[model samples]
Target: MSSWEIHAIKYADRNARVRGDSFVFDDNHDAPHPMDYFMWLLRRGEEVILVDTGYDDAEAAARARPIRLDPVVALAPLGVRPDQITKVIVTHLHYDHAGGLRLFPNATLHMQAAEMAYATGPCMCHDTLRMPFTADHVCEAVTRLFSGQVVFHDGDGQVAEGVTVHRIGGHSRGLQAVRVRTESGWMVLASDAAHFYENLFARKPFPIVVDVQDMLDGFDRLLGLASRPELIIPGHDPLVCKLFAPGVADHIRRLDPGPTGKVPR
Candidate 1:
């Protein structure tokens, strides 16, 4: 298997949030709990794979969530253009993660079959259930589907040599996590599987959940997919920037650890 280099590109954030907003049950529910939005980049040799394009300006305006930088502009410093991305793995069709589908015009989208069905299905009729999704984003995905630019994975599917996606339907009907073979070992990008370390460590599910039992099961699934607890990257914790790749000041942080016995220092 080819080892890959993973980078988390921070795009937007929600600062005025509390513990209660993040966790279903927490003692310090009144305490502050900020979220940092990110879109991961996985690269090896000449292969470039993107995971979950962050929301765009329109989404930002509608949701009242301001973006620090445009995701396309965020990629320029890294030398990756939106059109250059060949494969984009959308963990789920949540507004924050899948709103930028129109930006990547040439890339083939990879998503779980259930997610597509759920996003377009009757479940969206409920206001509470569909709050996290945007209609135009779903429409864009449908357009891509008709254009033959979408690949629907039933469950577990491989995107590249060492990159694979696993279906864990808790947060969404088809929410999946990306597991990549890295220098350290297997690293699982737990996109909304655990919004924060405490979400998994404390065994508490996020408030915005579709199925309570499945959300709890997904936490276990994230732990099982990763090589270790440390290798599992949470979806939206700001601590991720500090915990991984210390001394780096930029928004894009390196996630893969060094070899088994080798630390970054």
Candidate 2:
């Protein structure tokens, strides 16, 4: 099996949030619950595959999100450049995940077929449904499709020798999760499938969801995909940084090693 080095790079964070903002059924609805935004980098020898490209400055300004670093800056310490990136596995089309689609000009994007359809299809017509996406980002994906730089997957797809993507729609119409093979074990990147460990452990769904049941099912799917529960990484959990040790830089956490200790209660 091909072992890949995976780094979770936190680019932005939102601290002005509450439990209600994160979970659909939290008893402490008014309590604070911060969210950290991240873009994962997967490396093997000289090859690199980026998981998601976080939104750029315009998005941050418009949305009132204080994104700390540009995707390029966040990745520079690890010796990864946007131009050198050859492949990108877009977990979904939500603004945070796919807003920077044009960043990696040379890379072929891997995505779920249903994602594009959902983004472009009638589902986006609703105001609430469309708020999470930026029109320009979706247009950029369309541009990639026209140029044959976008690779569409129906359900499960392989991005590389030991890295695979599985459709685990719920948050978005075609949300997917990336499963990677590491020396320690199989690490499943549960992007938005579980925003926090609570979402997975408590069997609860995140608030910004399209299909509640699919999100619930995806939790089990994430656990099953990994060699163990500790190998399952949540998408926007601040607890991730606390649970996993820093790598290369403080914000860059090495996920391939799995967690350093048990999740704090």
Candidate 3:
């Protein structure tokens, strides 16, 4: 089997209250929460595939989110320069996910067809539907489209010898997760499909959802693709850093789906 190394590079983090209900439907549990923002990098020899280009400094200021490091900067430790990137698999087009597209001038973007339609179509007429997306980010995608820099996929397919992207819309119109083959096994990069393991295991859904049912179903789809529940990585959970040791450089983790030490309570 093809072997690849996967790393979750945390660029920023936030301390906010994730109302239990904000992430769970019909639940009224209010609590303080810490969330981390990341852009995943998959490497096989010299080939590189980046999942989701994280938001830039401008977005951090506009959204009032603190950014510890830029996603592009985070890649330097791994020795991956933007120009070295060949393909970027966009899980979704939210500002935090697709805002940094311009950073990679040499990469071809891989996105879902349904997600493109949802981002560009009439659904954006509603403010609630468009709030999570940035107009400039969407516009950048349009420019990429015209320049033949964007590759659209309908459903699940291989991105490389060991990388696969699965379409499981829930948090957005065409949300997808990446499944990668590693020395440990197949690891699913469940980007926003389950922002926190608590959301998936506990059956709680994130409030910013397009189709609640799709989000709910996405959890199942994630499980199916990953096979083992623990192999799936949540998009915004700080526990990822805790469970996976940091790489030689800061904020980088090499995922290994093996026995873990005692987790802090």
Candidate 4:
């Protein structure tokens, strides 16, 4: 298997109160459940794959989610130019995940067929289900679809030599996660499938769920796909920023532990 360098670029975060039952399904605690937003960058040799194009300032202002930096701009520190990105794997069409699609003009978008149908389907006619999606974000995807920029998948498939995308619809109808073969092992990017480490480790589902059963099953799928528990990274967990590559000034983390036993010095 080919190994690649993976980096999670955190753009925004929020500290808010969350009800345990809503998030955990059974637990009853109501306390602060901090969440972070990020977009991942994967590089191997000359190929670059971006996972989830995070939302912009307008969406943040509308949703009242705090914004620190634009995800596209955040890539500057990693020496990645927007035009150089060839493939962008959208985990789902949630505004926070797919809003920045326009930034990468040259990339081919990868999305699950079920997810696109869900976003544009009659299910979104309901307010509760449509709240997480932004009209413009979904519309932009439609525009891309018409332009032949989208590569839609019915289920699971390899994204590249070492990267693969798997469908695990729960958080969203078309929700998917990316798994990359790295020096450490297979690191599964459990975007929204497991919002935080607690959600996965405790089998606690996050509040924003489409199908409880799908969400629960996705946890098992993630475990089976990953090489190890530690290698499976959560989508919005603040702990990820700290644990992966804490001391670095920039958020970029070299996931592959090369010959030195550590990728980053």
lDDT of 1 by residue, 122-155 (tens): 9999999999999999999999999999999999
- Look at candidate 2 and give me any clashing residue pairs: none
Instruction: Give the CA lDDT, 0 to 100, for residue 14 in model 4.
Output: 78
Q: By TM-score, who's the top model here?
A: 2
Poorly placed runs, candidate 2 (over 4 Å): none
Off by more than 4 A, model 4:
19-22, 26-28, 258-265
Q: For candidate 2, lDDT tens digit of each residue in 158-263?
A: 9899999999999998899999999889999999999999999998788888899998988889989999888889999998998888999877999887789896
lDDT top scorer: 2
By summed lDDT, which 10 consecutive residues of candidate 4 come out lowest?
A: 256-265
Q: Estimate each model's TM-score.
A: 0.95, 0.98, 0.95, 0.92
- Estimate the Cα RMSD of every predicted model relative to the unseen true structure: 2.8, 1.0, 1.9, 3.5
Off by over 4 Å in 3: 26-28, 257-259, 262-265
Q: How well does candidate 2 score on lDDT at residue 122?
A: 97
lDDT-sorted candidate list, best first: 2, 1, 3, 4
lDDT of 3 at 199: 81
Full-model lDDT for every candidate: 0.88, 0.91, 0.86, 0.83
Of candidate 1, the 10-residue stretch with the lowest lDDT total is: 256-265
